[model samples]
Target: MSSIAIKFGIGKSTVSDIVKSKAKLEEFQTEIDDGDCTKKPRVVRKSDFPELDRAVYLWFVHQRCKGTPISGPLLSAKALQLYPRLYPDNPADFKAGTGWLRRFKDRHGVRCLSLQGESLSAAMMDVEPFREKFLKLVEEQGLTRHQMFNCDESGLYWKLMPNKTLVTSREKEAKAFKKPKDRVTIMACANASGSIKLPLLFIHKALNPRCFKHIDKNDLPVHYYAQKSSWMDSYIFKEWFLNRFVPLCRNALREKGLPERALLVLDNSPAHPDIVSNIYRWIDNMSLLATQHYIRYPTHGSGCS
Candidate 1:
């Protein structure tokens, strides 16, 4: 053993350790050969409840494939939800807490990271100044929580499909299929106090979908509009603001005996009409108190609204 260690340029203790771990090393090699393991991790730590952990992992993977954002709390909640079903007979004390979550992440090689955008590049210095200014303006204008509103639009990929899948060694290749690119933009608005939630503005590419052929557009729950790109534009926003939003606010205020005036807080979106120009003077003309524009600071990184 000493001569062999010297020949291989290894310490005698290392050779003895390797001899001791020979069986485990062989078993690991067998696992890699059989395609059960990828040889990424040196040690394989078995879970107490393998089936339960696997179910949670599958659920997590499914959600991720559908582009659903997952957080630590959500994962833990899901584990707790599925635990009872997986181990019906076993009355084990299983709490999916922080420790379990940490182990689960390590076991599945999962890491939390920002997949798309660089939010850290935002000018954080401007944030405090903006908050101060906004608060001061609200105080000076005597804008109550219910009288102030904020609106934003987000896209929903309704026809999203997973781009990746696990395949067996027997299969030559996994066939690719054209994924559906259907999407819609939904615009939602609500007051700071959550007292007033305006009807959603739903935008689609088609003017009249086949499903809604027999139905009346007027009876729809949302303020529906059509755009070629199925996205918010200046024309669509202006129409919704004047026809839908203004009327709804006016009626709600009348019912509650509040003042007709309201302060609409809007982010600097391209779809929003240029406030600097005289094009969108309806805020003042139509008895709406003011349009508070949240401008993104011009910086090296793209500003967030």
Candidate 2:
């Protein structure tokens, strides 16, 4: 052992230990190699069936479609619950489960590709069909630019735009004097014959009948003005339209000396009691003032906008 160590430049103790271990391992190998040893071929368990894996993947896909973020561990747990016969083993195979899910998603395009609601994508897809219907309606309704006037209420925040340009500290400090509270301005406009009416601008803490009192029977056109308002469950909408909106339209039309065959385009909103009562009374009385020149219903405002 000492001679061997010197030849190999190793310590005698290390050389003896290595030789003894090698000899012991060789003897063990020779014994194992004899008939006493039967080396059955090692068997590899096949991965879970593709169909089961695909089903698990689909489950995750559905959850994700509904805005749920399903991680691999969660999916594996779910699989165990759903298919105990298949996933009865340890959940450490979560990586394999997630891999199957990813494969299924890629193959079938089952993942949601939209950031917005599914309805938004559906609406976008329906645009072309909607346009075709709109054209048909326009023809059937005999709508011309002169006959159709667009009216919409828009809101504006009354404040100087926040300066985007970087300002020195001194400049900001100078302008730090208390700024006025921002105000919301609601304005409505009607356009006809290449002319737009002087916009009706009002600042109200909220939209209500009182806020719209300025619109009386004097500001409307005789022909239909396509006015748009949202559906809010309040009488204010009816009060504004019946008492203020329609009257203003009539008065404006009278002032323009145009005939009263005006159509008011409004969404289906429940009228306030006052407006509903007024409408009922007008209908009962069959009064000329109650007679609408024309009222056109809109399926939607896609083309109108």
Candidate 3:
């Protein structure tokens, strides 16, 4: 061996060690082959898939776009099933699905289907200053001046809960579920004065204008319907404000002791008729009383109104 190593320009000890290791390995292989303890083929676990993390992110995006409720186990199962279709031969392993989703959610701030209490807290923090300013304005204006009212329409869905419920992590937890297709209209008016009135009518179908049919000359108390594209027609504004909102405002002043020159605020929605016509009419009609009252905050002030 030493003579052969010298001739090949290699160290004799290095060659000998390699030969001895090979012999030992061969002997071990023989012993294993002769024994009943057969070596099992190594299985690639879900964690072995190189692209499992990427697959989980894609799945999450898909579900969010579709407005689907998602969870860790569900996402993992979905990723495993979809991996084969999306990546073919390099599908993600099933076992790593949950871990990938958890990591993805932590890194990206993906919210679950149901909002958590912490979310409400975050929103409150953002709006707290606005609320404080509003309260101060109300205090300065007095109850009559601040007569804040909110008018909006809500959809009453089938099996809707009357109140919000708490959520828990228990399996088979009771969830508030409802049929989305069945819904009814519920228009309501409420004020900071603690007065609330339900609309006299409710529409069984969403788009039916029949609920608004009764809002004619007799019921025009400062018409407050949301502006729609159709209301932008040449004569719609004149017809609505001149015939409706003005008359209602006059009547409200008489009945509610609202100042004759009360300010009327509204959004700058395209559907809104130009303020010039309405202002002219109010000034012409109310004269001196209109001096103290003028529409202020013409843009984005509808909420306060």
Candidate 4:
């Protein structure tokens, strides 16, 4: 080893390892009865200990589903936490470190990903289908660009994004959302002609918050409503449509000097009470309003962003 190391200008330990590699490399090659051992196949295993890795993966998925905050270091710490409990025989002798973490991530295909729930890719596939339906509806209703209106309810975090919004696949934990966050639901209605914009409804959990102590409620940017969870429901939707939306449309059309005939595009959901069950009642009530509009329902997330 010393002679080989001096001649190759390498360390004696490296020369010894090189000499030992010949048998190890040969062992990795295929052995056939035909005396041919040319192939060297790459093998994939779940982990050095696949059964233990499987348990870890299951635990990871369960915790993630519960919206637990997880990071690389956190996962490594967890592995250490579970090592003794999982392997009772010589548990303290187990090696759970960067090597295990790296292999575990690769095996499970878990990555640190920033997941935003918007940008519904599944909806994009139906854009062409929606266009054809939209055109057919417009022709049936005899509606123009000035008469076309859109209303959508969106979820927002006034303070910061919620930690539950972040998601990941496989045996790793999701990254927690940073910053303080308070959720708010907002509903808005506007015309394509940009002439009419009805009062935007901002849903809050509290009827009166400490933050609004100084600001006048009458001069607020949006019409405020309160609910236990600050969410829109069938009752609120009916009131907005019959009492608020109907009057706003009539006034807006009158201001623009356009005919009181328009289409109200709705954000549709199959399970929703307002857009599904109580929609017929709303349509019947529209006859009393000065503005005669038809309800144009688009599937959940199928509407234009």
Best by lDDT: 1
- In candidate 4 the C-alpha lDDT for residue 55 amounts to 74
Stretches > 4 Å off in candidate 4: 1-129, 161-179, 211-216, 270-305
Quote each prediction's TM-score: 0.54, 0.34, 0.32, 0.47
Q: Which candidate leads the pack in TM-score? A: 1
CA lDDT of each candidate? 0.76, 0.45, 0.46, 0.65
Better of 1 and 4 by TM-score: 1
Candidate scoring better on lDDT of 2 and 4: 4
Candidate 3 local lDDT, 1-305, one digit each (tens): 98889888999897797576786556545634754222432221223444655566666778657645566667667666766875676543344445666544444445455432222223335356645654554465443542444433344576555546566767456556653555554444433454323232233432326666655534643333333321233244445445543454455555666654433333333434465323424443642111111222221111100
Q: Between prediction 1 and prediction 2, which has the larger TM-score?
A: 1
Which residue pairs in model 1 clash with each other? none
Candidate 2 lDDT, 88-174, residue by residue in tens: 674455443566554433433343332432332233454576457545644755544443344443345566565345677667443
Question: After aligning candidate 2 to the native by TM-score, how far in Å is the CA of 173 from where it should be?
Answer: 10
lDDT tens per residue, model 1, 120-155: 445567678777877886797677888777888888
Model 2 ranges with Cα > 4 A deviation:
1-122, 129-134, 165-181, 192-198, 201-203, 206-233, 254-258, 266-305
